[model samples]
Target: MNKLRIGIFLGITAFAIGFAACSKSDSSANKPDPTENGFDKTAMLTNYADNLIIPAYTNLQTQLGVFETAVNSFMATPTFANQQALKTVFKDTYLKFEHVSVNQFGPAEAALYTNFTNTFPTDSAAIEGNITRGTYNLTANSTIGQQGFPALDYVLFSPFHLNDFSGPNAANRKKYVQDLVARLKTLTGNVLTGWQNTYRASFIGNTRSDSGSPIAFLINQFAFEMDQLKGPRIGWPFGKQSAGTMFPNNSEGFNAGISVALATENLVSLKAMFNGNGSGKGMSDYLIALKKDKLSSDVMTQFDKAINALKAVPDPYATAMSVNKTQIEAAYREIQILLTLIKTDVASATGVRITYQDTDGD
Candidate 1:
């Protein structure tokens, strides 16, 4: 990962903490309370199928096409600007990780663990080795330059880094790859746990309106954040690394790692909920109504469908790594759409009547 990404990740993490303090829960006392408004699960489900699930999934497919095309172009002729753009798309796509975790797994730790493993498997030896070794350069005697994208290393390598360009010591290199794979698994597991606890609690569980489920509010906030993060992945192909055989064009880890990282941010927010100062608790209460009317379960079910669709994205480690740019782009494109749609449904589920901003809007 580049410093820019690291910085963004860290910044987002910090912002989450601060954001938790002020708007943790909505005041339910002021609003109308939940009454049995016929709890229209059927109607909600129908609308969800038509408006939320189907549209979101379809949109994901379309975005995937665009992502593939853009990445293909950038791979053939990459530059710094394009690299940044690709990274942006990646960051945005990651928002789905949080959305999927909450809806699919609910608020349980076990559910989160399962979601992370399936969604962002941390078994890629090349990617982890690159990040570990990539922390600094041997010859450069300093960290890789600002434009030095360590994440690129995973793309170019064969499953075991076949060419052995990673280091001079073949034996050490092999050991490194093995170690890296293990480390990635450990790192991702840690990150997933942290992310789930933080974001979900602070945002989703915090708001509990009979009129509007706290779950819905949580997804909405996530979608809003995701829309903001959408540029980097698209820009990756256009980077200096994207054009050459040196970069190898594999985006499997790049995308997966990013998504997992953002998920970490959401978990952080969720953690804040235990505190009265935390956003999760505060936001949940804030959204509840004085009047107890049943919020639609149909929306939640539709949201669930979207979550399942996101979960449908094949495990990153399951597929063979592709060296060809076209193949890699195709893979990324396919996954990108699913991620985008996942965010769309999450936003819709939040049921926030306000016009939510699309953070990544052109």
Candidate 2:
């Protein structure tokens, strides 16, 4: 969830703007087909599509179904008990989102899921503005910050923390919450449908490793998500960019204070996707075929380091940014190491040109 940027995907390049894979050389597909190395690109693609990408979206659909029903129950009852239930399912669904987030190339790009689904420290002013107005376009790009899981995090835990669902502005607040979940369900479900209906066959069929190939998109996004973990998810709130001044509230899921868990889950997703979610053919397998086994092994080792470091940080991450400063800094450093490995070392090894602009200059 980016803070400084709103329209951009923060880490991913402009594949969502158009058919960037066809014309752009730096985003998704940028490397020549490496089939000469006997890595079985088609098999890798099939494994990713069948085992990793599609399955992630499918699970997300299930969690979102649960989340929508939870919202329905809460809105119907508007009680403290129902509110807590909604919070539980919200975190579950948000965690599921971390998995699908890595596959933000084919159908996810078509849905602009990256652009809308996760931006935080959400626009509190904009969100309140929409709620008070009692009408706003949740689907519009202008409403991006107010449209995602982060926004729901705030709506669920912070603003209405005192079980105000049945109190002041009850109708408007309930309507806003309902609209947010509805938008999330519709947009995310459409992405899943796109994958199941058509994108799956094409993604597994095209084995070419061009500037627009699915392999490049997957690998590029792997690094992009890692970069995001290093910066927005960890560094920005830890004050890596602001002269050692902490903006702890900038933490993703700040209101719910699940920042550490979200960051840990993001790293876990990248590592899982990289290693084929445990057993399938992933980028590490391709690296092994190319005889870059050390790089492959180093990447996994660093993923462990990063995940462990992040998990070391206590919950309510914003508060920990001050109370647990040393632990937060250590986690940030490990995340930086992982980013360098994936974006630079691994990108070079895989033959994909990584391109995404950020002011942090890391």
Q: Name the candidate that leads on lDDT.
A: 2
Off by over 4 Å in 2: 1-15, 18-34, 159-163
- Predicted candidate 1 versus true structure: per-residue lDDT over 51-137, tens digit per residue: 332333334334434444544444444455554575555344333333332222122222222222222112344344544564422
lDDT of 1 at 83: 49
Candidate 1's TM-score reads 0.35
After aligning candidate 2 to the native by TM-score, how far in Å is the CA of 4 from where it should be? 2.2
Of the candidates shown, which would achieve the greatest TM-score relative to the real structure?
2
Number of clashes recorded per candidate:
61, 3
Off by over 4 Å in 1: 1-11, 22-161, 165-167, 187-217, 220-229, 235-362
Tens digits of per-residue lDDT for model 2, 127-229: 8888788989877877877878878887878854546577787788888988888888888889989988998887876666544677667767887787788
User: What is the lDDT for 147 in model 1?
Assistant: 14
